[model samples]
Target: MTQQHRTALKELQKLDSRIHEARQRIAEFDPRFEEVEEPALVLEGELNTTRNRLKEMKLEERRLESSTVDRRDRLRRLEERLGSVRNLREEAAVSAELDMVRRSLQNDEQEALGLIDQLGKAEQRLGELEEAHAEALRVLEPRREALIAERADARSELERLEGERSVFAQGMNPDELRIYNAIRGGGRRAAVAELTEDGACGNCFGIVPLQHQNEVRHGQSLIRCEACGVILAAPEPGSAADAAPAEASTAVTEVAVASDDDDGGDEEE
Candidate 1:
């Protein structure tokens, strides 16, 4: 591969990493959207439960009303029998029975009144719950749409970056592409490392031999680090230089602009 191809590959790696991160960030927001909607969902569930309870209470009120009617009819029959009593003993027995029936009727009436009051209170509470549910929906509706729009925007940007990355990668040498893919597939963030000022591998911090360092600076051939198996490239321009190597190994001044991982050296002035 030409020096230019290696240069393009380096730029491609950086873009690829950025695209990956952008997509990851967008994916992360899915849960956030769900969280935003949770309050409304919870309120809806509560409202449904309350409405169901109100239905059951209404049914109970109807049952109580029916029972009250039955009791009143029984009281009327007892009174009519009292009027027909012929003897004093029978009359006294009828009076006692009449008193007992009156007490039962009064009890039923009191209970019916209490149920009606409860029904009124329950209806009021139901109205409040319904209003609360509507308000919750109103509050979140716009916020939810905003979040959705934000996600759509992020996705669009991710797609654009991906397209740029694909075109950039296509310009890279096939051999370089295979090597980079292999390193990335192994879960390493950087497929290549730039040598440090002190001639150390940027990824593993392992020292590189003076001879291999020269080879990376020239960008003529791909060189892998013996210690970490990462493709080694020379540091970028403007990086701090260590004491100039003794004359015997001083020829590696030119930088190849080769691919490096996010571990790109902090270039020193």
Candidate 2:
């Protein structure tokens, strides 16, 4: 590949970097959106509980009404039986049953009243909870919409960048683009790096042979740092003399990173 191809690859890598960061930004809004709606969620839960309790209480009220009617009918029957008793003993027995039935009926009436009162209160509470939930949602709408719009904007930008990247890649040499993609597949940032000031691999800082440095800076074919396997490119003009002298070594290190697993280096300044 030519120097121009490496420069284009670096530009493409920069675009990909932005895309990665945009995805992360979009993901971050999930928690924030949940937080914004939490108040409404809590209120909604209470409203449902209150409504269910009211339903159960109304059923209980109906049951009590039916039991009251049955108890009244038994009381009438016992009163008639008392009048037609065979003797005083039978009359006393009927009277005792009448008293018990009256007590039970009274208890049921009292319980029914209490249940009605509780149902009224629960219904009121439910209304209040519903109102609060609506209000919570209303209060949160602006912020929620803002977050949504912001994330949408980020996504749009990401789409635009991706489209641009696709078009840019279409015009690039397929082999070089494939190599760049393979180098970046492992999530390393730098797909291609410049040769450092003193003939060292910029990515790993490995001392490159003078011959390799010359070819990377001046020739057209791809040259990787064998130690880390990062594609090397030509350094920027006037950078060599200005860069601080770095420590160098001639010991050759084994290539720990394969082509597909190799990471890219930091962006060039």
Candidate 3:
């Protein structure tokens, strides 16, 4: 293949890797979005439980108040009976009954007072919890909205990159495409590797032999660094001296291929 063709193939490879990375990022956010949902649901449930408890306490307080009124009425009737007693025995009996009714009233009143105290405290606590719940919803609502928008944007970007990658890959040869796919499948440092001054692979930083470095510079043959296994491209001429060897190698490969084809035809005839 021509040097230009090789360069185009490398560009396409890089684009394809970017597309894959974008898709992976979108996938990662999907679970994160769901993770946020669970906490919101849990908080809602807790708020509902607090509301129900508050309602129950209020109902209990009302029932106690109603009972107190009935007790008070009974106590008044017992006191009137004490005043109407005719003899010592009758007076003692009425006095005992009145004493019993008074005790009952006192007990009911104390219980009602206690219930009121409890209800007041519970209502205060409920109010605080409601406020907290409101704040939580307010905070989480915006975060959820932001995350939703982020996910949508990521998906859109991923789709666009994928379409671009498809276009990039259209004219690439199968072997070159395979090498690109293999590198991308490995990690983020796929397809593209920088040339080092010491003729080492940039991705792995391993020392590349002089022979391989020369081959990469020529840009005619598809060259991969043995140590890092990244596709090596020659740097533009006059840009840096480190890239000269690889560029020369690319030229050598092109000339060799041309000569071999010519010799083979002669032998076949």
The number of the candidate with the highest lDDT is: 2
State model 2's lDDT.
0.77
Tens digits of per-residue lDDT for model 2 on 6-86?
666767877888888888988898999999999988898888888889999989998999999999999999999988999
Q: Please provide, for model 1 over 1-269, each residue's C-alpha lDDT reduced to its tens digit, 9 standing for 90 to 100.
A: 24454455567778878888998989989898888888878878877887887788788878877877886887788789888989999989878888887888788788778878887887888888788888888988898899889999989999999888776676566777788889878988877777777788988989988788777767667888889888886665544354333432333334422333333232211
Better of 2 and 3 by lDDT: 2
lDDT of each: 0.74, 0.77, 0.68
RMSD of 1: 6.8
Identify the leading candidate in terms of TM-score. 2
Q: Name the 10 consecutive residues with the lowest summed lDDT in model 3.
A: 260-269
Instruction: Put down candidate 3 lDDT per residue, 51-118, tens digits, no spaces.
Output: 78768877877776787787678778877877788899998987887788778878878887887787
lDDT of 2 at 2: 58
Task: For candidate 1, report its TM-score.
Answer: 0.69
- Candidate 3 matches the true fold with a TM-score of 0.56
Higher-TM-score candidate of 1 and 3 = 1
Cα misplacement distance, residue 181 of candidate 1 (Å): 2.0
